[model samples]
Target: MSSKAYRVALSASGAALGAIAAYWALLAARQGHILFDTRKLPVVALSGDFSTYSHTVPGGMVRGYVYHPHGEAALQDLFVYFAGRGEDVRATAKALHWLPEGFGFAAVNYRGMADSEGHPSEIASVADAVQLANHLRKAFPHARLHVVGRSLGSGVAIQLVAQQKFSSLQLITPYDSMLEVAKKRFPLVPLSLLLRHQFNSLAHCIGVAAKTQVLLAERDDVVLPERSAKLIAAWPTPVSVRTIAGSDHHSIIGFEETWLLLVDFALTAVLAMPEAV
Candidate 1:
């Protein structure tokens, strides 16, 4: 081909690459919104006595709910829960019924969700977790604390565990990283380069020392079965893996068996620490 023709071809290829790069950048900028669904939902009455708590963070305040066992006056054991994206934690007040008596239950609403203020981002959420954990630790010095996270919250939980020690750690339908999930969904995009909020749970798991349990949905399609498998394989600490039968991504939490397994794991140390698979 002539030199002029070759130059023209090269110019066209460069223009195409620039366009793709711009598109990826736009996607990256909107990642936070895509990752966090903060829509407010109808509030449901809690089963037992509970109190609302709030903590100030950069930009705004983070709100959450705490439930106490029927007869308990002191914090015997604490359970800190992190719900999935798009979940209105106020609706999760019903979960208090499933928790073993004597355990204090707490769940946080991400920024801009429900009564919480400010915008939500990966960094801000993790920072808020740390702040909340520290506050709870000081408030109940003698209580044994356990952390439970579902879906997107799993990433936040892992990061918290890496920085703080807990009695136990529970993850439900977690992913290795948001970047990995994005890559799977948008294979042609350069997510690794453009992703701004990369919640790399696999990296965060390396330093977690707490006894861990991973609950996987048998038919998970949102996070993918392989993604959860990858995190389980990469976990440095001993972790017990259990699958909820006949459950998918959205329906897994609705099963009675799911709550039974979680409550049992949280309340007892009978779960043998199997070697990481």
Candidate 2:
């Protein structure tokens, strides 16, 4: 209870606050580089069902590409995909060969990734993805839109769903909150306070109008199976969860077990269809 000690502690706290404010100011001035790493990834536009282009899209232009079968049913809604951290559209396209033939897919480089412009190296760029999805839905009024996200992408997708009403939502290896993920990444940081971007999906899960498909990579090292299970616990039943058996985080894309589960989930989980009149 020494008055001298209390004064020193108070002074130190003020200095800490000043330093944090300065660091955050530097981050704020740097616009879209939130997620863009500037490392170019291979973009393969398929002859029939897939095409790649760097377009200026809603919420700032981004580098993105689309994929579909040569004769895919145009009636089917589009799949707007979000990829994992330190990853881009190339991973999904390459994994396409592993997937069944049906549906269309678009994987975008969020603002600041690869050839994408703007300033981003964090999940704040997810706001841009949400805007892009809304624009896509409005642009293709006829095509019912669906959004799918993987790994770190699940956080981006959750934000989009919270903001936009989509046909369906697919989340793979999703964490409960960005705070949970930040804590996993940085045990030293006081995750509750230090984390600025909390894409708290659980808080908004009830607002999701879209029927969801939860895909958990079995034995996943990157994102534990428990995380997906936890999210599904409160979600609607008939709310399906598919386990990519014998698959891990990095290998899920290529594993036969993973693709089989996805094929069933993708083909079966159509968003909006009329029931009995």
Question: What TM-score against the true fold does each predicted structure earn?
Answer: 0.85, 0.73
lDDT values, one for every candidate: 0.82, 0.64
Q: Which regions of candidate 2 deviate over 4 angstroms?
A: 1-49, 52-60, 71-75, 98-102, 121-124, 236-238, 256-260, 275-277
Deviation from native of the Cα of residue 53 in model 1, angstroms: 0.9
Cα deviation of 97, candidate 2, in Å = 3.4
In angstroms, the error of model 2 at 137 is: 3.0
Give the Å shift of residue 249 in candidate 2.
1.1
User: How would you encode candidate 2's per-residue C-alpha lDDT over 16-57 as one tens digit per residue?
Assistant: 998877766654443224322356666544455555555564
lDDT of 1 by residue, 182-218 (tens): 7877899877777878899988899898888999999
At residue 90, give the lDDT of candidate 1: 73
Model 2: lDDT of residue 240: 73
Report the number of the highest-lDDT candidate.
1
